[model samples]
Target: MPVPPPLRQRILITGASAGLGREMARAWAARGRDLALCARRPDALERLRDELLAATPSAVVSLHVVDVADHEAVDAAVDDAAAALGGLDRVVVNAGVAGGDSLGLDGAEANRTTARTNFLGAVHQAESALRVFRPAGAGHLVFISSMSALRGMGGAMNVYSATKAGVSALAEGLRSDLVGTGIAVTAVHPGYVRTEMASHFPRMLMASDPDRATRAIVAAVEREPARAYVPALPWAALAWPMRLMPLGLYRRVAG
Candidate 1:
């Protein structure tokens, strides 16, 4: 059952320059929430903050130039954003890179970058958010894992898949750690959202528009579930059965 979500929240979203992160900022701002936007692209963040402020006069929009891969920087950014927003009620760890070639193709550097950005970067964000939430005893942490996390993927997806699985694990582990605590966490597994992340792919299964995907994700995040498959539909129904598929068949189907 879905419970009533906190309205007019103070949200800090990493990677708010484009794609799902950008759309989520818009969705939250439309609801008149305070936003702390962070991304490597400072110019883009400023534009988005301006747009949000223009659209909703009452919305409190702030920008933080951040690179999530830098642990110390991420920690500082989260603290700064929390202070700017008067304490964060929710933090969305949404920054990630889909860059990586096949492990077989000697793509070690690419694989390393992917792992660093996705897993280590997320660790910094989650830790920082928990610091804010622990004292508040009432906060939500949202991680944007992927449906690819259901199983290990090969080709260029090898590193990406493993990193997402780690992210999901973090959410699951946090659920156990926060038992009896008021803080909440959710891992959102979205299937092929039509953002820059999936734009290069030639064939995408159950592809979803960015706006539509953001709305669904925001809804699930607000509900504060331990885990959720976004744009539920076919994705939610298929999650379990897909996980049960044999590796050989999954590789073929995935490719």
Candidate 2:
């Protein structure tokens, strides 16, 4: 039998304090994978690190308190984490925030924040990860974009959708650019997931549990899939139609 890929490889995950990132950490720990987890919240990061270490004796967990939006800080954190892990085989850019208001007031500020956190932050994380991957000659990049990127939405989510779209494009471009380098880039477009990030939205809008969504993500990584739509049902079906729909129609349907 062919030898299976080692589950003990070290991986780095941003925004690992909660939501999908937290669940991804749990999924990885269960498989005995070492992790370098980063989030703005130090307390939560420390707690998660402790929990993972306790649950998986074979896995090593390191926690870093840093914000992805801060490019320099993120670069330093990634470098230190990569060093501590000896090297990184995978990096998940999951840190993001939703902005823009339904009322449209202060929309500029919201859009700015959204662009900075969602698009630029992912770029920073990816650059840091790739810096290590390029030299090492093998690694994986997991970008956690949203299903909203498939279509332009109205209401308070316009900028959020735009940022997600940007992230998706980044992943696709990276995949093409890194061809034959043994580095795989996976773009994950997930529908509404039940997490603190979606709490502001109606409960009906939230579709999948974070744990289930994360399982699909990690599975896609292990399989080295090019792109993935979590749950892979209505979401996969809706992607194209949503992209072609008019703004008015999308707003009415999305709202």
Candidate 3:
């Protein structure tokens, strides 16, 4: 049998106050991973830190209150977290916003907000993580993209989907750039996973509950693949078909 790869022990996760980030933190903590949890809500971060530490006494859980849209804050937070946890073995760029409306209908601000938070914020996180990882010569960088990234979407999903597409492309580009380095990059395109972020959107077919979705996401991160259609059942099977579907039919099936 092949030897198992070493698990990433020190992890940094943004948007860790709640939803998938929080759940992923719990999953990793259960496996004895030290975590640096970042989010805008200090109280929520504190509660989660306490909960994780209480449940897994051996784990180190540090909290950083940050708005990922601010690059300077993100840089400082990532560096601080890395120092707190000794060193970072992995970073999960998961902070995002779903706020956006129809284009050219006085929704520019909303669309821009989504774009900055989802795409630019991801860029900031990735840049900061690589700064720490480069010297170490080993790290896992995971981007939480969306299944919507496979194709262009319209209406409220327009800007949101576009940002995810950029995120996926960013991960691919980074993976290509780091070919010879020990660092690994993974872009996880998750299907409709029930969470606070997806609450406002109309639920799609084959939507997954949080627990199952977190399991799939964590499992994919552990594998550190270039890209993973999370759950790896329906989303993985639907990737090509979704990309190839005609606009008219794709809208009907996806929306």
Number of the top lDDT candidate: 3
TM-score of each: 0.95, 0.93, 0.96
Model 1: lDDT to the true structure: 0.90
The segments of candidate 1 whose C-alpha lies over 4 angstroms from its true place after superposition are: 1-7
TM-score attained by model 1? 0.95
Order of models, best lDDT first: 3, 1, 2
lDDT of 2 by residue, 1-255 (tens): 999885568989998999999999999899888899999999999888888888887788888888899999999999999989899999999998886775447677877888899999999999999999999899999999989888766667878888899999999999999999999999999888888987766323548887778787788778878888876766877778888888788777786
Pitting candidate 1 against candidate 3, the one with the higher TM-score is: 3
Clashing residue pairs in candidate 3 (N, C-alpha, C atoms within 3 angstroms)? none
Question: What does candidate 1's lDDT look like per residue over 1-255, in tens digits?
Answer: 999885678999998999999999999999888999999998999899889988998999888998898988988998898888889999999999887777867778888988999999999999989998998898989999999898988778888989999999998999899988998889999999888876755458889999889999999998888899989997899899889999888878885
The local distance difference test score of each candidate is 0.90, 0.87, 0.93
Q: What lDDT is obtained when candidate 3 is compared to the true structure?
A: 0.93
